[model samples]
Target: MATFSLLVTANPHSSQGQFSAIQFAKTLISQGHILKRVFFYADGVLVASRLNCPPSDEYNLTKTWAKLAIEHDFELVACVTVAMKRGITNAAEAERNALTGDNLDPAFEISGLGQLTEAMLESDRLVTFG
Candidate 1:
């Protein structure tokens, strides 16, 4: 099975890119492929925001993605630069920044762009969604 890396570059609440990426990841895994990592860039980092809440009837994109990551061992890496600029800090970052609290989902992680580069270099395929 081929190893795959995914880059999700869209805002979860503004477009369908996140949903499409989720489906693609699921399909690849179900087909017995290996998923290396899912890199969240730009506004895509919003998917790691614990503050995200859709209407009761609407899909909870953030939670869905988190659940997928938890069920599988795949990494959900959110770009720290983008997340900080957008105020999506984790517990340590929030404390350091004197923010009220952290809202980053537990299933996601904050990291640098180097992780994205690593995924590209190490994986057999790199798929982007935006």
Candidate 2:
């Protein structure tokens, strides 16, 4: 089984790529492959936002991603630069920036490009979705 790391650069709600990435991750895991990490960058950082409230009938992308990560024991990392720029920040970042609150989900971690590089170096394959 191949070990894979994924980079997602698409917006969770506005783009289809994000959904595809999620499906791909699920499929790979079911097939006995190892998904080491999913690094969210660019518009993909939106996936880490806890404030996302999709219609009740719609797919809860953020929650689904979180659940998947927890179930599979993989890392879900959002690019710190993009996430902050997009107003998606963790408690630490919000406090540091003097923001009123943080919208980043607890299930996701804020990190830099180095994490993505490390995932690439450690995994057998690095796939990009966007």
Candidate 3:
């Protein structure tokens, strides 16, 4: 089976971007293909934020992606630069930066763009869902 890397760069509330990413990742897993990584960049950093509390009726894409990553063992990485700039930092980063609290989920890691580059190099296909 081929391994794929998905790069998501759109905001979490954008229906097109969020649904498309979830569908793509789920389809890849269902097809027996491995997901090497799910790299969140730009506004996509919002997906890693645990503070995101959408309405109960709305689909929480952040939780959906987090669940998928935990279940499938895919590396879910949020771009450190983008995430920090967008105020989506983990406990350690928040502490280091003197931020109030950790706003990012544990399922996703804060990493550099180098991780995305590595995913591109290691995977059979690199698909962007923004």
Candidate 4:
């Protein structure tokens, strides 16, 4: 079984790439592959925002990603640089930056590009969606 890492660079609500990536991850897991990590970059960091709320009838990719990660025991990491620039932050980051509040979801972590490099080095395949 191939060990995989995923890079997502698309906005969750504005693009189809996020959905495609999610489905791809599910399929790979079902095929008995190991998912090492999923890195959210650029606008993809929005998926880690706790403030994201879709309509009751619409699909919530953020929640979906969180649930999937919890079920599969994989990491959901967002780019710290991009996330902060987009106003998404954890408590530590918010305090450090002197922001009024944090909106980053608890299910996601904020980290640097080294995490992405590590994922690429450790996984058998690194797939990008955007």
Relative to the true structure, candidate 4 has a C-alpha RMSD (angstroms) of 0.5
Which scores higher on TM-score, 2 or 4? 4
For candidate 1, list the clashing residue pairs, or say none.
none
Best by the TM-score measure: 4
Please, what are the lDDT tens digits per residue for candidate 3 over residues 31-103?
Answer: 9999989999998888898888999998888889889999999999999998999999998999999998888
**Worst 10-residue stretch by lDDT in candidate 3?**
10-19
Model 3 scores a C-alpha lDDT of 0.90
What TM-score would you give candidate 4 relative to the actual structure?
0.99
TM-score of each: 0.97, 0.98, 0.96, 0.99
Each model's lDDT: 0.93, 0.95, 0.90, 0.95
Q: Which of candidates 1 and 4 reaches a greater lDDT?
A: 4
Error of 2 at 24 (Å): 0.4
**Per-residue lDDT of candidate 1, residues 51-114 (tens digit):** 8888999999888988888888889999999999998899998888899989999989999999
Off by over 4 Å in 2: none
Evaluate residue 87 in candidate 4 and report its C-alpha lDDT on the 0 to 100 scale: 93
Candidate 3 is scored at a TM of 0.96
